[model samples]
Target: MQRRIIIAGGGTGGHIFPAIAIANALKKIDPETEILFVGARGKMEMEKVPQAGYKIEGLEIAGFNRSNMFKNLLLPFKLLKSLGQARRIINEFKPQAVVGVGGYASFPILRKAQGKGIPTLIQEQNSFAGKANMVLGKKAKKICTGYDGMEKFFPADKIVVTGNPVRGNITQSSVTREEAAQHFGLQRGKTTVFAVGGSLGAKAINEALHPLLASFVEKDIQLIWQTGKPYFETAKTAAAAYASHVKVFEFINLMDFAYKAADVVISRAGALAIAELCVVKKPVIFVPYPFAAEDHQTFNAQSLVNKKAAILIKNDDAAAQLGTTLFSLVQNKALMEQLEENIGKLGNTNADMVIAKQVMALIG
Candidate 1:
């Protein structure tokens, strides 16, 4: 008999990519395994999941609006409608297990699955668990975590520290520095710095680096910058003066090359970003998005800073401190090498497989 499973959630690349990684791992483990993805309608996963060659069903759901209470008036109705839709999908798919990867669609599908006495797994990808995951964790058969000490959030007995699954391209990258440099239209011998601020772009990171483009050129340093969409024009205009040394992108499709080309990285401390950084083994200075739920991004960065594996800059201080910090770190070869070695020790390249096997265990 073919085993069927439903994986749910996704809003950002953080949630969507890891969810796809798990689905891929499951297929690799059993070619006969049937998988269906459930995501919030109009979310990124609806498009990205299909691009990855998987079938997905979208729920008419939206997350709670934290900024404007007026926008949340229809939230309850949306949730109820989504729950009904989730039940129909579950009844038709008849999945042996359901996995929630954290996002708006996750709650309805997993809640409906648990109500039906179906085995469900929760993959909590943060140092601090969200309200939805914490509530669902009560009935979950297993809670897979990306960070240690998640017992504070979920049932300790059901928790398994599986580390977050990173995209395969990064974990198995064979891109050399020369190839990466050529791909980005930069030179191999120059010091290269890569900055990424998630998929939406970071205002602090962009503002901090804007005035420093000339300094980068003067120092003969090369920068490959992913400005997201909003910051693309501004970043492009700023880099126009130093086109030879700076490459600006709205969204980088080939991150494996970016990682290989970089000597040091400046990034936001999101869980998936941290997971990929661990695999790439680059010396990283993390500027945690201060607005993250429970300020979890800060906790994520501090975890590595405590291990001497990475550096942290508060979002508020990025404008005043980022350039100086980057310059000093680039000059310190020993510290860079030390950070790279310690961070590499934290990478778990097989997390997708481990989580897949656990899901299969639930099926048995």
Candidate 2:
């Protein structure tokens, strides 16, 4: 029988990319498997999902505003409306199973699916589960996790450690170091550092690195920096004086090359980024985004730090500590190699395939 599945989530690349990876994996395993994405309207998934060649339906939904009480007045109405929309989508699509990837849209769709006795699976990317996932986990047929010890958050029997699914280009990249350096117009034999702050760019990282451009050139280091859109112009302007050693981009489209070129990386400790770094096996200095839900990014980074697989610099301390941290790690060959080896052990290149098979099992 032909299978149909709904993958729900979005808001950030961390959520959307994993969802897409799973969708692609499902198709690869069973070409006739039909997949539909459910995301919140105006979120990145609406555009990204379609671009990945899947049909998507968006609900008029928004997460509760924790910082401001006044803004949450209409949240009840929105939730009620989205629940109705989710029900309609479920009925119209008749999915064999629904997968929740942890975003505002996942709650309603998974809730409705569970209520109807349809199997639902959740992909919780963070070590510290989000509230939405915690609630939904109660009724989900299975909960796929990126980190271990998630049994504390979800039912132990329902939890499976699948690791986070990373984009194929990253996990399967064949880009050589020489090709990577040439792509960035950088010279070989110079230690390269790739600093990325997620898809939208991280302000703390950009600001911390801005004053250190000259130092990078002085040390003969090469930098491939993704400054995100907000800080791009200023970062580009600042990096112009040392153009030979520094490359500044608003967003990097070819991340595989960036990973190949780097001896060390500076990144926000988002789950997806960590997953990719592990797959690529690079020594990383993580600056956890402080405002993340439940401060889960910190938990994500600490998980690796505990395993001796990565380093952590708090967001508040990045300005003062990131530069020193980066320079020291890049120069420490033994530590870098150790980190690379330990982190590599944590990478699961087949997470998408594993999750897809799990979803298929629920259908059976």
Candidate 3:
């Protein structure tokens, strides 16, 4: 029989990348496997998934707005519409198994699949599970997770610790520091710091790093900044004066090279970000996004900090203290090495493969 699968989710890189990784792994195992992606309309996955060489269908869906009650008034209609769309997609696709990587679109597809008596899997990419996954857990046959001790969040029997899947290129990258520096047009000898706040950008990190650009230039430090879309223009204007030492981007297409070029990294402690950082084995200072559900970013970062694998800076203190703290990190060679070694120990490079195998097995 032909094996057909449906992978659903995506609003951010944290979800999209892992879904792609798992899809790629599934393909590698059986090149003839038919995989279809279901995502929310207007989400990044619509573009990103196809670019990664897979077919994706978008449903008319949007997540709840906690701050705006008016926006949520239309949510019930959207949810009903999306559930109808999901059922049609599942019926037409006739997938042997459905995998949900947590996102707004995931719930409807997984819920419908479970209702139809199809095998289902939910990949929870956070230390704390998202509400969508929590709700879907009752009917899901398996739950793949990036962290341990998640019995409180889901049925312990259903949980499988597969870790989060990072892009294959980054995990297997052979690009040297000098080669990566040349890729970014940065000088080889200078201390390079890569600061990122994920794909959408972090306002606090951009603001904190903006005032310190001149200080970095004065000290002959090299910088790679991913300012995200909203802050790009302003960040570009500030970086214009020191173009030689600074490279500012709205989004980084070549993350493999970016990870290779860094001596130190400052980033948000998103689950996917933490997984990639572990693979890159770089010294890191994480600023957990405080507004995240259950303050999960802090929990994600704390897991590493407890193990002395990374340093954590609170969001409130980030703008005031990040510059000075990063300066100290860059100067401490011993601490940098310690962090790199310890974090590297946590990297699970074969998570995509593990997830694919388990999903196949559970369905069989």
Shift of residue 134 alpha carbon in model 2, Å = 0.9
RMSD of each: 0.8, 0.9, 1.2
**Tens digit per residue, CA lDDT, model 1, 1-364:** 8999999999999999999999999999998999999999999999999999999999999988778999899999999999999999999999999999999999999999999999999999999899999999999999999999998888899999999999999888888889999999998699999999999988899989999999999999999999988989999998999998999999998999999999999999999999999998999999999988789899999999999999999999999999999999999999999999999999999999999999999999
Cα lDDT tens digits for candidate 3, 1-364: 6799999999989989999999999999888889999999999999999999999999999988777889999999999999999999999999999999988899999999999999999999888888878989988999999999899999999999989999988888888888999988999888999999999999989999999999898989999999999999999999999898889999998898998899999999999999999988989999999888778899999999999999999999988999999998888999999999999999999999999998788667
Candidate 1 Cα errors over 4 Å, as ranges:
none
A best-first ranking of the candidates according to their lDDT comes to 1, 2, 3
List pairs with backbone clashes in candidate 1. Answer: none
Rank ordering of all candidates by TM-score, starting from the highest: 1, 2, 3
- List, residue by residue over 1-364, the lDDT tens digit for candidate 2: 9999999989999999999999999999899999999999999999999999999999999987878989899999999999999999999999999999998999999999999999999999999999989999999999999999988898999999999999999888889999999999999988999999999999999999999999999999999999999999999999999999999999998999999999999999999999999999999999999999999999999999999999999999999998888898888999999999999999999999999999999999
Error of 3 at 63 (Å): 0.5
Worst 10 residues of 2 by lDDT: 322-331
**Displacement of the residue 110 alpha carbon in candidate 1, Å:** 0.5
Q: lDDT of each model, Cα atoms only?
A: 0.95, 0.95, 0.92
